[model samples]
Target: MKKHTIVALVQDRPGVLSRVIGLIRRRGFNIESLAVGHSETPGVSRMTIVIEWEDVEQVVKQLYRLIEVLKVSDVTDDPVVEREMTLIKIHAPGPKRPEIVALSEVFDAKIIDVGANTMVIEMTGSPAKVQNFIDVIRPYGIKEMMRTGRIAMVRGVRGHNAEEFVENANGHAERVPVMN
Candidate 1:
C-alpha cells in the first residue's frame, strides 16, 4: 500500500467535509491523515488528505463527482513540502522539566505551556520528526497529545491563480473559479 497526498478545493458549505470522509470510508480507503481549512479564496476550502491507495486516479474521479468539490489534485508525486504540527503535554516536574526542555531544544520545539506537573511542547516539522519526538518523550509520560494533520503544497508554480485552479480531469480541462 502506497501513501498518497491529495489536495482538494471544495465549496465552503456545511456537510461537505463529512461527505468526503464518508465516501472514502465507504470505499475502504485507509485515510492516514486529513486536514481542512479556509483557503486564500473566499467561499472555498482546501483539504489535504493522505490515504493508502494503489489507484489514485479512481479516487480523484470519485471526488470530482461531488458537486461541492471544485478541484482535485494528486500532489503525492509532485515536489511538495509537507508539514505537521504536534502539541504534547508531558509530565515534567523539577528535574524532569529541565530534561524535557533540553530534549525539545534538539528538535527546536517550544515550551508553550508549563505547569507544576506537566508542560506542553509544540513541535512542527515533517511527520517523521514529530513522531520521533513523541516517541522519545513517551517515556516521560504523555498527559495529553494533539496533532494537526499534514498540510502540503507543491514546490514551484502557483497552485492557484485568480481563485482559479486549472487542471485536466477526465481528459478535459476543469477550471474551477471561486467567486469573489
Candidate 2:
C-alpha cells in the first residue's frame, strides 16, 4: 500500500463533505488525513485527502460520480507542496523552560504562549517535520497538542481550477466560468 494524496474541489454546500466521506468509506478506503476549507472560488471548497491505497484512480472516478464534486486529482505522483501545522503545549517548568525554548528554536517553531507551568509551541512544515518535532518533544510530556492535517497543492502553473470544466447531466464535459 502506498500513500496517495488526492485533491478535490466540491460545491460549498451542506452535507457535501459528509457525502464525499461516506462514499470513500463505503468503498473500503481508509482516509489517513483530510484538510478542507473554502477555495479561491467563492462557492467552492478544496479538500486534500491522504490515503494509503493501491487503486487510487478508481477512487478519483468514484468522487466524480457525485454531483457536488467539481474536480478530483490524484497528485501523489505530481510535484507538489505540502504542509501541516501543529500547536503543542508541553510541560515547561521554570527549570526546563530554557531547554524547551531552545528545542523550539532549533525546529524553527514559535513560542506562541508561555505560562507558569506550560508553553505552547507552534510549527508549520512538511508532515514529516511536524511529526519529528512531536517525537523530539514527547519526552518533555506533552500537555496538549492540535494538528491541522496535511494540505497539498500541485506545483507550477497547473492547478485545480473548479471553473475549468464540469460534468454535465449527459456525462459530457462542459466549460463553466468561475463565480465570484
Candidate 3:
C-alpha cells in the first residue's frame, strides 16, 4: 500500500474530531499519523492525516461524507513542507554529557533540560531527520520519547485555507473564494 498524506478542514465543534476519526475507522483505513489543531480561521480546524492505503481517492471521498469535513485534499504528491517534533529523554551521565551535547548540536536539536543522569532534547525537523537523530542517540539509552505526528502544508502560495470553503444553501461545501 502506498503512503498518502491528506489534509482536512473541519468545523471546530465538540465531537467533530471524534466523528471524523470514527468515519475513517469505519472506512477501514489505518491512519499512520494524525495531527489536528486550530487553523487561521477561528471556528475551523485543520487536520493532517497520514495513512497507508491502496487508493487515497476513496479515502478523501469518505472524509467528505462527514458533515463537519468542509474540505479534503490529498497532498502526498504536492510540493509541501512537512515537519514533526520530538522530545527525547536520554541517559546523559556526566562523562557522556559533552558528547551528547555535541551530537545534538550537529543535528540542530536543542537540549531543553538537563538532569544529573539524563537530558531532554527537543528536535523539530522532517520525519527522516528526526528518525536519524533517534538512531544516533539510541546507544546512549533513551528513557522516554514523545513525538508529535506529521504536520504538512503545501509550499508557496497554494495552501489550504479553511475560510475558502463555505457551506452553500444546499448544505454542501463549495468553494466561495480563493485564499492566496
TM-score to true structure, per model? 0.88, 0.90, 0.90
Please provide, for model 2 over 1-180, each residue's C-alpha lDDT reduced to its tens digit, 9 standing for 90 to 100: 999999998877789999999988997878999999977666678999999989989989989999888889999999999999999999999999899999999999999999989999999999999999999999999999999999998888887666575556754445577676
Alpha carbon deviation, residue 32, candidate 3 (Å): 1.1
1-180 in candidate 1: lDDT tens per residue?
A: 889999998877789999899889998877889999977766678999999999889989999999989888999888889999999989998888878989999998999988889899999999989999999999999999999999988788856322564334443225565676
lDDT of 3 by residue, 1-180 (tens): 888899999877789889878877886778889999987766678999998888789878988888778889999999999999999999999999999999999999999999989999999999999999999999999999999999999999878776675556654446566556
| Cα error of candidate 3 at position 165, Å | 5.5
Candidate lDDT scores, in order, read 0.86, 0.89, 0.88
| Residue 120 lDDT, candidate 1, scale 0-100 | 91
Report the candidate with higher TM-score, 1 versus 2: 2
**Model 1 lDDT, residue 119, Cα:** 92
Worst 10 residues of 2 by lDDT: 166-175
Q: Indicate whether candidate 1 or candidate 3 has the larger TM-score.
A: 3
- In candidate 2, which residue pairs get closer than 3 Å at backbone N, Cα or C atoms, i.e. clash? none
* Candidate 2: clashing residue pairs, number: 0
Error of 2 at 42 (Å): 0.4
